[model samples]
Target chain A: MRTFFNTQMEVLNSELIKMGSLCEEMIELSIKALQEHQDFYKEILKLETQLDRQERNIQDLCMQILLQQQPVAGDLRKVYSALKIISDMERIGDMALDIAKIIKESPLEYQERLENMASATVEMVHLSIDCFIKQDLSIAHSVTQKDDVVDKLFYQIKQDVIAGLSKNSQESEVFINYLMIAKYFEKIADHSTNIAEWVEYSITGNYVGEEE
Target chain B: MRTFFNTQMEVLNSELIKMGSLCEEMIELSIKALQEHQDFYKEILKLETQLDRQERNIQDLCMQILLQQQPVAGDLRKVYSALKIISDMERIGDMALDIAKIIKESPLEYQERLENMASATVEMVHLSIDCFIKQDLSIAHSVTQKDDVVDKLFYQIKQDVIAGLSKNSQESEVFINYLMIAKYFEKIADHSTNIAEWVEYSITGNYVGEEE
Candidate 1:
């Protein structure tokens, strides 16, 4: 019975890690498609369907483990964490998809500031998934701190857009589109931070996001 | 033994439902304070600490149940679902607190259109929480359809802000503030949609948030 339970727990943990990898890949590929202005967004969109399917799959697997194995104590926490992490990962995937679609539809010229912000977000996503997969509390802690970096980048982009609006009204429409895209990117990183927080919770069994 | 497990499960369920009530009240009061520009902003800030405390209490209780009870299949699912739902509720609380702070620091001189968007979101939050409380699949299903309402409102706000930029640059800061706040409100609704979808999953044990 102990071996069976251990195997089931291992499967659940690996499955969640798989979902985490998918989320990271989608974010990276979507950004590359945008920055390169390639036709690769089609691929990103296709991957989004995979994200949707994987979300349901992970949730189902966690539910099955919780229902069939009747996970106890630490095992139960792992299953619960999988369920929450999957939801956050799914949203992170959606934000990436949204960014990819925006890039695909407009294919606009990228401003330097927007490019920097997008790149910073790409790095943030990479580090976030790394922390999740490694379960490195220090890496997770670093990801939390760098959330301010993404936020600062976002603030700079917003400021540039605001400044642009004052001097050049003709480009403001295009600017707003870029701004929304940047906002979406910031949100993607925010969701990644959320996943990292879940990783912390799974380890500590405490709600670390709140001031407790 | 079964009776002991059932009692623990019951406590977890009821506590989660109570936390849901706090989440609903926070979202509602925060929106009301913003829309009315009343002195309620201060009161809403006070509620944030209370909401955080409630979230901490529930998670601790969930930990106790999982550790001590070793509940079976159905009961374990109930406990795990409570944990997942409370996390969502806590995120919703964060969203509301974020919006309330935005309202306080930068008072909105004009927000009729933004208020309309918030009103739609207010409706969505109520319906979504109700779905969770009642475990009503119909309500949960309806929430998926209405997600686009918040999306549309977000788009409309973005367009209005961009247009306002060109038409009246003087109100640009105000418009941008409104845009960001609207975006936050839309996200709060998105988080609510997440809860409703999870409620669907919990009741039916079917992961069903995928676009179909």
Candidate 2:
């Protein structure tokens, strides 16, 4: 019985890791598409759907594992953390798709200022994923720190866009859309930081204090 | 043993209701403060903290019930639903506080426009809490439909404010803050709708498709 339980737990762990990898790949592909100005990237949508499916699958799998195994102590924490992490990952995928849509709909050269926003967001995504993979709570704490940077960048971009709108009020509609884009990027970073916070909590059983 | 088990489950159920009531009060008071401009009433941070503590406590209670009672089928669903509901409730409280702060800090008001937004949001809150108390899936689903109404109100208010801003751009900062207050109200409505969706899922085991 012990051997059976250990093997099943191993399988669950690997399945969770695979799901996390799927999330990471979706984020990476979305960022690449945005940076390269490739609006025609059909694969981003496919990856987004795949990520969503994986999230649902992982959640269902965790419930089954919990019911069947009734994992104790640290094992229970593992399943619980996976449940929360997958949720955050799914949201991150949604954020990626939102940015992809922005890229697809807008003129390729129009969102140049957003280039900085995407870069900051991608950096946050990478830091979050790294923290999860390594279970490094310090690195996870860092993800929260960088969220402020993303937010600051978002505000800076917003002001610049708003200023442009006020100068050429005719383009206010277009510029407002740009501000929304920046807002979306900032929200994505926020979700990624949320994931990293879960990593910290799962490993340390502590809420990562707000840095700012 | 059976009597002891049932009593324990009853206590858990009572705790769940208690936590839900606290969440409901937080939403109601937040609306009261925001709409009535009673900034002092926004000092419900203690309610948030208490809700958080209750959430964790009820979670623990649920876990203990699951182990001791070994709830089956419907009882199992009830326990798990309590767990999920606490999460949604905690977030709802957080958002309420966020909106409260907006109400507390902002000196500028949009006169009747702010009232319109508050009325829309509070109506949604009323409907959501009603659904929650009744466990009426239909009412819960209907809350999603009204988000668009709140959203339309948001845009109308925003347009009016922006036109007002055009008259005196210095007012743009205040109007944007006002816009955010409306947005936060909209978000609280959205979160309430989300709770409703969870209720539907608890009853039916599937999302009935949110009405936007």
Which has the greatest TM-score?
Answer: 1
Q: What lDDT score is found at residue B12 in candidate 1?
A: 68
Task: Report the lDDT tens digits of candidate 1 across residue range B47-123.
Answer: 77787788778777876776676565556656666766676777778778777877786777546777777777777
lDDT of 2 by residue, B1-212 (tens): 56987787678767766776776687777767765767743357889878888877876686677555556555665666566566666766776776677667765554776677777776776676677567787898788888778888877876775566555554444555566667666666666676677677667767443211
The TM-scores of chain A alone, one per candidate, are 0.91, 0.86
Model 2: CA > 4 A from native: A1-4, A25-46, A100-117, A158-166, A207-212, B1-5, B37-42, B66-70, B111-117, B151-168, B207-212
Number of the top DockQ candidate? 1
Q: How do the residues A45-112 of candidate 1 rate in per-residue lDDT, one tens digit apiece? A: 78888878887777667766655666665566667667767777777788878778777767767777
TM-score of 2: 0.81
Model 1 clashing residue pairs (backbone): none
